[model samples]
Structure formats: C-alpha cells, structure tokens
Target: MSSLALHVADKRPEDPADLTGFYAGLLAVLNDAALNHHGWTGSVVADLGEIGGYVYMKIRPGEGDEPFATIEDLRAFRKRQAEEARRTEEASKQARLI
Candidate 1:
C-alpha cells in the first residue's frame, strides 16, 4: 500500500466558491474511481480552507486481496466525522452557557 498527498492551490480564483468547486471536482474523480472499481482499496482525506486545500489518500488491498471500500463509504465516513465534530462543538457551547 502506498500513501499519496496532493496539495492544490488556486490563486487565479478570487472567489472562494470557484476554488471550492474545483476541489470538489477533483474529489469526485477519485471517489468515482473507487465506486467503479472492485479491487480498489483506498480512502481520501480532503482538507479545504479559504487559502487552498490538500488531499491525502491511501491505497491498500483488502483482506483476501479484494476491494476495500467505495466512494460512498468514504463520504459517509467524512460525514460522520464532521457530524461528531459539530456535536462536540455544540456540547461545548452548551456547557459554557450553563
């Protein structure tokens, strides 16, 4: 298994939305490959901010040398992580209010 890290910067786009869309498109391509292939095993982490972004991915074979997960799976994991962070922040806010 090999690990890959990609850093992307878009200075041409003054609008943050444009930069974000560009990043999202790149992620879609990676996720699409995961969805279409069976023997593809990897997860991608996208760190997007106002300045730029980075994508960290790992490729590995699954047990029995099968595909590990799909793009949807990665997306679900990201969603869950984000939700957990949000919940934690909310809890902290509530605690501070008390």
Candidate 2:
C-alpha cells in the first residue's frame, strides 16, 4: 500500500548515540513532512503496531491525486490511494549505504 524504509542494522541509531530519545529527535524533521504531506502519521501507527521507521512523503507536490470518498470510487481510482496496492508499478527495493 505504501513505500517503506528498512534500517538493516545490529542496533538502532539513537542507542549508539547514547542520548535519550535521540533517534526520535532525528526523526522530527521527517515527522513534520510526513504529518503535512500524508493523511496518516506513521509514528502513531508505529506506536500502535510496535514497529518503527514507517512514513509518508509527498513525491508529487504540484500533482494532486484523484479524490475518492465512496467504496466504489476507491475501487475505481487506483493510481495511488491510502492502503491500496499498485497494479501499474511493481514492488521494488534498492539499498543505499547512506
């Protein structure tokens, strides 16, 4: 339904830094963007689901997606909608050292 960032690591970043809630602080900027651009907040989901690092981003700032309210409307419009799979674009992942 959405893209995810995987942190392949032996430990979480903030733990090594040894500062209280350090990773959360680092994620604040991302949280801001996620809150503004996307309809749902990932950190809240993370808290409920006991997971982390999930978020939403506005890749197309100028382009707006078709709005759908009804269930049939949702079923019809499928370029990108919340929690819906993409038929046009295949799933993929590319790693970076960063």
Candidate 3:
C-alpha cells in the first residue's frame, strides 16, 4: 500500500536561498513521516509546486505495486546493469574478432 504526504509552506519566498531552505525543511518533515508511517519504507517519489503564493510538496511511496528500493538497492542495480552491459559489449567484440 502507498500513502501520500502533503506539506504546504505558509509563504512563498522570492529569494532562491529561501526557496531552498523551504524545500529542505519540507524534506525533513517528509523524512520524519516516512520513518513514522506504517508501510512506508523510506523509498518515495516527491514533487514540489507552488500555487496561490504557497509552496507545496507531495510525496508518496514509490511504485506501490512493487517492493520499495533503497538508495543502496538502486546503486547495486545500476552496478549490475553496467556490468551486464560491459559483458555484452565484450562478447560482441570477441564475436567480431572471430
């Protein structure tokens, strides 16, 4: 199951640094939610937007149908994919040499 977490900033800042700070604070709140929320295992998809002079963030558990993937999991998957691609390329080169 997936859950959506929403956060709204009281005021939108004109300065980029203030916007960054707002996002940072929002992420902290979302991280806390991820820690406390049941069925939320830290993997999330989040989006930020502004409307009516307010900044809003929406976060949800990533891909509800599948098991969540952590940063380590994604890194390992990327490594494996790269390795497989390298092996395939090497095999192609050997075949060409034949």
lDDT of each: 0.52, 0.32, 0.60
Candidate 3 TM-score over all chains jointly: 0.49
Show model 2 residue runs off by greater than 4 Å: 1-18, 42-98
lDDT per residue for candidate 3 within 23-92, as digits (tens), equals: 5566667666665764565544344556898866555665545444343443454467678889999999
Which model is ahead, 1 or 3, in terms of TM-score?
A: 3
Off by over 4 Å in 1: 1-51, 58-66
Top lDDT prediction, candidate number: 3
Q: So what's the TM-score on candidate 1?
A: 0.40
- Superior by TM-score: candidate 2 or candidate 3: 3
Tell how far residue 17 is off in model 2, in angstroms. Answer: 6.9
For model 2, how does the per-residue alpha-carbon lDDT over 19-85 read when each residue is reduced to its tens digit? 3243344344444544455542343212111136432221211124432122232223322343344
Candidate 3 residue pairs in clash (backbone atoms < 3 Å): none
The Cα error of candidate 2 at residue 7, in Å, is: 8.8
Cα RMSD, model 3: 10.3
Model 1, residue 29: displacement in angstroms?
12
Using TM-score as the measure, the top candidate is 3
Candidate 3, position 53, lDDT: 84
Shift in Å, residue 95, candidate 2: 29
